[model samples]
Target: MTFLLLVLAIASEVTATVSLKLSEGFTKLVPSIIVVAGYGGAFFFLSQTLKRGMSIGVAYGVWSAIGVAAVATIGALFLDESLTAVQMGGIVLVIVGVLALELGAAH
Candidate 1:
């Protein structure tokens, strides 16, 4: 349940971040509202995940890393953004770093 909540939190955060770009500095009403709601839900679920006893390091690391990667992909795919080789490598590194954190936590 906690893991699931954490995933939700990450998704919500990513959605909010993407919406932020679409919001155009909060000029757009709908995406601006979405940004607020998405971020609100994200923090709510993230707090729940922490309350469920997941370590802060693991939870936040996973959440942030996944959020960064997701947002980057979304930006590139839908927002006409560039995804250079260096950016792709950075995304891979973020995933790898998260995996290493999870592995380290196991023992």
Candidate 2:
């Protein structure tokens, strides 16, 4: 249940981020609304996850790490954005760091 909530938070954050790009400085109406709603949903779900006994450090680390990776991949694939080798490495490192946090929490 907590993991599902975290996934919802991550998805909301990623959607908000992608909508931010599509919003074009809020010039577009639909995406702008999505930006607000997505962020709100993200926070709400994230809070639910924390309330379910997940540590702040682990929850935030996983949420942000996965968000970054997903947004970057979506941008590169659909928005004509570039994802360089270095950035890819950084994403990998972020995921690894989040994994370390999760693992460390298990002990």
Candidate 3:
């Protein structure tokens, strides 16, 4: 349940980030609304995860890592953005580090 909430938070954050780019410095209408709502949803869901007792260290680490990777992938796929091999490797490392954090947590 907690992890599910975290996933929601991650999705919301990613949506907000992508919409942020579309917002064109808040010059657009619909995407700007999405940016505001998406961020609001992200924080709301993230807070729910914390309230459900997920550790902040683990949750935030995973949230941020996954969000970065997803956003980068989306950017590359649809926004003409590019990811270098080095950047890809860094994404993998971030994910691995987050996994390590999760695994090393006290059970």
- Give one clash count per candidate, in the order shown: 0, 0, 0
Q: What is the lDDT of residue 77 in candidate 1?
A: 93
TM per candidate comes to 0.96, 0.98, 0.97
Candidate 3 TM-score versus the reference: 0.97
Error of 1 at 44 (Å): 0.6
lDDT of 2 at 7: 99
Off by over 4 Å in 2: none
Estimate, for each residue in 27-107, the C-alpha lDDT of model 2 and write its tens digit: 999999999999999999999999999999999999999999999999999999999999999999999999999999999
lDDT of 3 by residue, 1-96 (tens): 999999999999999999999999999999999999999999999999999999999999999999999999999999999999999999999999
Give the winner by TM-score: 1 or 2: 2
TM-score of 1: 0.96
lDDT of 3 at 69: 99
The number of the candidate with the highest lDDT is 2
Put down candidate 1 lDDT per residue, 66-92, tens digits, no spaces. Answer: 999899899999999999999999989
Q: Which residue segments of model 1 deviate by more than 4 Å?
A: none
